[model samples]
Target: MRSPDQRLTSEAKVTAQSMLLDPSNASTNPVENWRACFPEIIGRSPAMIAALETAAKVARSDSSVLIMGESGSGKELFASAIHRLSHRSPQPYIPLNCAAIPENLLESELFGHERGAFTGADKRRIGKFEAASKGTLFLDEIGDMPLALQSKLLRVLQDKKFAPLGGNDLKEADVRVIAATHMNLEAAVQRKSFREDLFYRLNVLPVFVPSLRERSEDIPQMLEHFTEITNSNHSAPSVSFFTDAAIRMLCKYSWPGNVRQLQNLVERMVVLKGGGAISIDDIPSDIIRSIEGQKEQAIVSTGADFQPNFQQASSAMPLAIGGRKQIAIPDQFGVLPEAGIDLTSFIEGLENGLILQALERTNNNRNQAAKLLGLNRTTLVERIKKRRLAVLNEPSKEL
Candidate 1:
């Protein structure tokens, strides 16, 4: 028999592993059950799935999630998904776009102001926190939020309370705040453009929504989806397939604007082409115009305008995606170093990498792992089979 000390040490290690891996330890994956949260969120890309999984994990706890991505990359969509999967799913999910609101009025908008609170004081109004009582309040484009307001937000997040703009009374807010931003808040903090305190508070959990061009494989599905929707309103033919030539044309473009851009293209195609089996000829003039250059003739590459080519020398070593490393893109790409370089085959590699990470962290909690990675449980399973991630079908009861 083993000594008591040895057994105790072994048990402790097992417990730690279980806690880190177990969904039961964290609470049921409410996000798994709440599918409506991502009503508009499209794509089954592994990168996106991994992001959703991380967001769901962050959601279970009351940690404030800082969503980072390029503008129009669907930061708010994931924010909404997190709220819908939280305990506060039944409550309101309020969105405040910091960039859109006037700096002076933001305070009154967040923390209700008393009548005569300001020159334009209307009446006693509830702030976003109060309005989101027991629910989630999403702060969109928080990086653009005024530096003056960041301090107040940090205070409220820390204290769970806020004072109306002109009122002395401190009101209690039971709201869960989830902040989103496109700017590099970390760089912002270093530059002192954003407050350090607020960054830490919001950075407790971070969710990323990858760009559309980042996962071009999802383009085919998204194209079919948009085409199907458009086919309903107007149609000469109820066809489903795109000509290989047309699909090739799409796959080549860089899609700089991401999914919204793709959606725009789809809408344009549907209206302009009058809906049917789309041949390359049926494609729009602007899209046609953009692809006419010799660079576009390659078809495999839409050129640097979309996913600018960059070469990374690190394919030999395993790059950790979920580990504690801050995202850093190589500088050689000549574009924003933050966006990373594109690879012809790296899309497949990314899929494998994300699936492996999700399984590693989730300890095979398909439901929890799926949420951590932002994958549909079914999709995760499909990928597991496709990539063969070696996960348990049933969630381990060890938790």
Candidate 2:
């Protein structure tokens, strides 16, 4: 049958697929109906599921939707999904980037200009508002629109009518607006850069898309999706898969650039390292440095904080220590001080406190105390003997 190399390759492929497609048990997991609406959106993390649920609910309405997210987090995909699920799915889905056009031409871009209206205007033109009639107009980077343009946009949203530049006739507008911005519009309003009234108008129904770092669980599936798309579109031999170690390192990455960065990495690998499984060595040097740097930083920080942090961590255990001055723990206590602690005394005190609390709760029943502390009865007895702890009674014997 198959050669040993071929069999190994098949097994690796299966393992990669399993790793990428593990089922999630999150309560907000997207159902089949909702998933069907967003076939292009490639994530099943709880954060993604919650966002999908929100988009599905808001899709039925014709109200303005303001999508807030970090750049490259796929705000446009959500906008398209909402339009697809809405009643206006049959109509044109027009999109315009507010930040891309110049200030002088932006007004004309939103609400067409008449022939000879401006120096460059040669013929009559329809803007996004008129072009997106009875459909959805996705305004990307709406936060960057100039103040003058913002006022005109607010008027159109309120009155549903606008006069073409150099034309007096008011044109009736019937368009559903879906705006997306990575900026905090409230902060912009506070700065008096963005119009407060326009912000509220667009924010009637708000949707937030989580960043790649927040939905790290979805990275494997996303990596797989990007790989498949890259292989299919490119003319080179297929970049088949990645090694398990490589995938683990990728998951640990913070992904500051989010999905776009991940996709670019996959495409770069396909072009440079196609035709085989990509090992950890295949990953870019900068990414490896970043992951390693985070690990080192975590280790150093945790080690410095471990003693006091251990106290707080152990406090979360089932049994609370008894009969001590209940002083509030301060934030500064989490850090290691210059004086440092007596390790032996600190450990013994913490252990004794827990044991004493457990024994008190169980009324000096050795077996019960052992159970509470998740220790063997024999082990608990040895500890008590070594510590010379005084037990008042042994009424309940071991079963």
Candidate 3:
């Protein structure tokens, strides 16, 4: 029998491992506890929190999960989180990108081949399904899976058994599947490119991850997190920080490529700036141009000529949008004092003021406010959410 000290040491090690790996030990808050399960997913926005909650609830079930999100929005990360939070976490978590493989070799890659299964099949090879038995298999870009493979995959999910190529024997598949897709599978099904049956089977538990722009409030935190991670990964002396002005400017960006693009930008900045305060001046010209382009469009939408230079703002400038009342410019307007006005900030402030006024006029009715602002309800709601305005009511309630 082992000594008491040895047994105690063993127990302590186990406890420590459990403490680090178990999500329950992370926090007292249920949402935070779930968030702890996904350490790599950085966001506290309501949309992200909702997604985490859904993922946490579904993680306990053995049903197949379908993660839907735009490319680079971290659909695969969500899949991994689901696997990690599942009973199959101790087992392997294999990921395969259906879009990355060729149609000829994709089947063999998913379901291994026996010796001489095909021209290149010289030896028996394990496939993702067999390799992930008793664990989780993440099929990324599953919408891109060929129709032929989709039928076979559906069969495996249904029968829990698959046969290898050139082999008569069937192997048991005790795998939990988590599929992710940026494509609209419903549309693909209508287009006859994707199997409708497979889509429904995998979509038993659907989790929609919000894009970066939908949760822009998380950008500052994400930026800081990315900066620290990049600094540590690159062995920088210290972590870099973005200036408040720089962060505000970045928050204005649409982030079309989402989290991946932000992560790449953080790495680029850490490498280029050598770990220091990153100001708006340090921001890439393309990013600035993108923001400027948006502002130019907003200006044009107001029936005003696009003014590239803020300093050249004409006095008594008339602004009209969708037959709205024209703003009466003051004589002192556009005249810069010793401290020149930040036109971008001024425009944003004006926009917010108008939105607030519209909401008030409509008695916090988002749809009516949107109509008053000459914007669609969806666009208005998005703006309100981005600005964190809690005054608006549900779009369903007109009054």
Best candidate according to TM-score? 3
Q: Ten-residue segment with the worst summed lDDT in candidate 1?
A: 308-317
Name the lDDT value of residue 242 in candidate 3. Answer: 92
Error of 2 at 287 (Å): 0.9
Candidate order (lDDT): 3, 2, 1
Give the TM-scores of the predictions, in the order they appear: 0.65, 0.68, 0.69
- TM-score of structure candidate 3: 0.69
The number of the candidate with the highest lDDT is 3
Over the stretch 280-350, how does candidate 1's per-residue lDDT look in tens digits?
A: 88776655665554253433211112222111111112222233332222212233322333232234345
lDDT of each: 0.65, 0.72, 0.72
For model 3, how does the per-residue alpha-carbon lDDT over 29-91 read when each residue is reduced to its tens digit? Answer: 666655554665789888899888888778889999988776678888788767766777678
Q: Whose TM-score is higher: candidate 2's or candidate 3's? A: 3
Error of 2 at 154 (Å): 0.5
The sequence of per-residue lDDT tens digits that candidate 2 reaches over residues 1-399 is 111122224443333223223434222434543454466688888888888878877877889999977667789888877776677766878889998998998888888989999898999998888888888899999989999889989999999998888789998989999999876565466468899899999989888888786789999999899988888887776556777888889998867566888999999987688668988999999788767765665221111122222222221222223444433222223343223333443455457667766777777788999999999999998776544453324344545
Question: Candidate 3, after superposition: displacement of residue 92 in Å?
Answer: 1.1
Q: Which 10-residue span in candidate 3 carries the lowest summed lDDT? A: 306-315
**Candidate 2 off by > 4 Å:** 1-30, 298-399
